[model samples]
Target: MGEQQNPFRTGGIARGHRFADREREVARIGQGLREAGGKLLVYGPRRMGKTSAIARALDLEQARGGTVARADLSTLSSLADMADVVLREVTRAVAAGKGFDDFLAEILKRVNIGFSVKQDASTGVPIPQVDVSMRSKPLEEQKLAVGEVFDAIDGMAAEHGIVIGLVLDEFQEIHRFEENFSEWNLRHIIEQHENVGYVLAGSKRSLIDRMLEADGAFYRMFDKLTVGPIAEDYLVPWMEERLAPLGDGAGEASERIVALAGERTHDRMRLARHTWFRAQQAGRSGRGAVDHAFAGLVEEDADEFLRQWVHLTVPQQNVLRAVSMKVKGLSTADTLQRFALKNSPTAVQAAQVLVERELLFQRPGEKGYFFDNPYFEAWVRERTAIDLGMEPPE
Candidate 1:
């Protein structure tokens, strides 16, 4: 067979082999799950390794002969999709081969009496999907059906002699029910359950606590764990060690990777993957190779970057340019005036929109917002002549 692909990966869950520098966090999560139905509310900005950490912990749990089910709630578009998927994952993890519609019908027997099972018209096999008769039902009743799905899953998992670890990535999607409907309802049902070790991961702090007010649903519902940037001291040595198999300057190459990508784990891995291949082409490794690789990244991502930019309003584009330029007091009158934005409100609104879209990421407990994708941010700065201040080696 051809040699294996690059060890560094980006844009998806990092499993046991590739995930780095999160041993302590992984151990904490594993211990929580190993306890009797332990719960965790893991919070971090996007790409900061929250999902990876949960996946790693769950992998360890599975290794120890535990049942672990996971679903990315963000992919579900409707309240019905959420109910179907959660039931699907939990059932698949506990009892394999049962389709989502069958498992869902079994669970909803009590809460949703107005749904039917239908076979696939698109195929020869019996691929079934549930059809709820409550098409015009009140949103509250619809939300409650999803909550009951969780309750039923908990009951089944408890019967199996151990707690099932259910990791819900992007748990904030629960708020799609409007106001606090989904979060409040789910929180109530989840809290009363005893057979599910639930770990919820989300990037947006505001949405994570959408129901966190004193009168809120999930106010103190979780034992919160904040995932942050993997410290450079821990990361650089690991990078140097991993990069060594590639050849000569892998020992000296980690710093350049960190310099370009800073402390975000996935971004560093991606840029390093590109840098390693670039160094392979040049037959050496150093800061110089890092530069060529980065320039190549700017080129590779040009079309995508333009696609992102053209969708922005002029004010949003101006706010992004200000961020790219590293202008001081980003929402202040001085900065907005300097960046060509008309007023503080416009600049503030633009910044919030960018943040919400995750084109920009405001670090947890940090001062400024930066591009979620580091390479994209680098392109912005270089395109605008914002001087990243890195120097290629001689």
Candidate 2:
């Protein structure tokens, strides 16, 4: 098959993954790693494309001959898996020309994927690709010696004069480790090297921020780079190019697409892809196409959303209903009466659970709240009126 006649895409990491408009950030990461040998933190909520941006930035440095490896610690079920994965990724990237088997004994673990030698046909130099996938074995399932994992990576960076980038995606999950390997220990290894740079990113904004606080282990250590949603201008034009062939309905379809997605990078792309697919299949465009696309997303998520709703307690569902409807004065008596919630305390408790589960989040630096998953919130309002016994809005 030739190049895409279709440009809408929204699956996977930053490169091929619904990627757009982080030129300034990409440049910042590259410059920090290159000039300052910076310990940088690229963090944001989920699906904001931190992984892709970091991967792209590291690729740029690699183009300039930097040896960079991205180890997604998120893929591991047990904390023990992380140390081994990182050691393997770093060693494989700087392996010079050796294969995964060469270091299997050294790392004392085996992964399904191979990191064997490959030579560039043109330059004859090795370009190590990230071999690990998201598959995880339980902690009780496997264990490995982590003692030399960090040290081996750091030594390789120093020994090879290679600039190594440790892009630890989902850095907050380190707290979930069974053995309680604290962040301070990781910070210690990171601090020892000038040649190695680290990009720590995660979705839980509050938790990740705690890791970087003044009294924290990584205090004053990293240059904080916030990765937020892509600008509207950047997203719209790229979307238009893909939707252009759809004709008269394309403009409305595109506008509806972005409007529903609400500055979320993944949602914008996924919705556009859905809209395009819907329009193509129906041989039509415009409001109908957009609505069908919207319906399709809600429908695809119906079971999951229902499961989520069922799992919530009565108060949580009520509070979620209020939040979904964009209720004002959340803590006030009127709000309590309007939602038939027990009281302000009940509302507060329910909201906290929703936030922890990432159903809702406070708008960054704002007092107002917003749904982390907007489609699910919309679904709640559409599907729950009769079930919840709430009268339909006027």
Candidate 3:
């Protein structure tokens, strides 16, 4: 039963001995928190363990007597909704800490909510009834609510010396519904607030980049931190340590598993967990190391990974396929021509979208783009049966 949870966590933080790498990132975040209330923006391609890293960081913060609150902004529709959620969670978290009830009460007073304290007539024991409302409001109301939430945060900070760290996951999604509503206001509040720290993380690179760069409203408001793929050196040692308890051939098997994952941090950890589960299912045989057979299992399940890729537009699909075929390298012009795209502007637009989605990543100091994840690249190669070693025309 214990062996069952070893492989592949599709959602949430990796638990047990499954978490690998990011020691340096954790330390850096902790140090930044200790410094003059810092804001960290963790941007990476999807499924790269951005959330897991934040979760792990929060755990470390708690161990050191710090307060951390996380809010998933994906489900939130407007600025008001976001503000309410953040305030509610932050208030609850502050209330949980010893001697922090007063601080929590101060924040709660600014927000509109029904709170009932029922006392038994005879026993005098009280029951707390907290009825929270979730409703979308007008833009003006949203702005006020957001401002009040920030004010409450400021008030709490003034009373309690401890700094507050708020992590908003999928922050890019705020633009989808809010219509340039929250970004500028958030920037203003963050700029004004002293003891409040923020970590805005998102899977959408283009949105995040536009918010930080370009003449967009949030320009230069955040300290950029690109959470790249996890280091291989850290992954290798961590995997060996995780598998050591299994048996004699476990260390070698772990290496083979990591190799199969192709060094993309999240994929490597996910694949390692999957391989471990497969090995255990095969009776935890100490003699048989994780090898091509386990690799084949991952390959067989490739469709599961490609589901998101399959949803791309036809033009995006064609461009991605063309890039995959030209594995060696292809000039931007040649790639467009290879895909038989007549509209040069449209092709460029499609390519840019693909890059933003992280379906493609630019090869540093190189001309052409490459698939962000090797597994996806391999899947594309196998599906197309194309050799990408040939260089494009000069």
| Model 1, C-alpha of 147: deviation from truth (Å) | 2.9
- What's the ranking of the predictions by lDDT, best on top? 1, 2, 3
Candidate 1, 192-311: lDDT as tens digits: 877778888787777766656677776776777888889888787877776666566775688888887756777788878887786666667677777777778878998899888899
Off by over 4 Å in 3: 1-10, 34-36, 112-134, 178-180, 214-220, 244-252, 283-315, 332-350, 363-365, 386-394
lDDT of 3 by residue, 1-394 (tens): 3634453454567744566667766666665554445777888777777777788887777667777778788897666567766765565556444426565446457655444455435544333333334244456666666677766776676567777777878877767655546576677767777777778888766677678876875676677766777766666666766556555566666667666565466666666666566566664523244554445654876887578667888777766777757634343566656666556676667778878777787644677677777666666656543444443321
lDDT of each: 0.71, 0.69, 0.65
lDDT of 2 by residue, 165-279 (tens): 6677777777776364557766765677676677777787877677789888778888888988887777777677667776557777777787877657777777888887766
Give the Cα error of residue 189 in candidate 1, in Å.
1.3
Best by lDDT: 1
Model 3: colliding residue pairs:
7-273, 327-388, 328-388
Q: Per-prediction TM-score, please?
A: 0.82, 0.83, 0.78
lDDT of 1 at 105: 44
Name the better of 1 and 3 by TM-score.
Answer: 1
**Poorest 10 consecutive residues of model 1 by lDDT?**
385-394
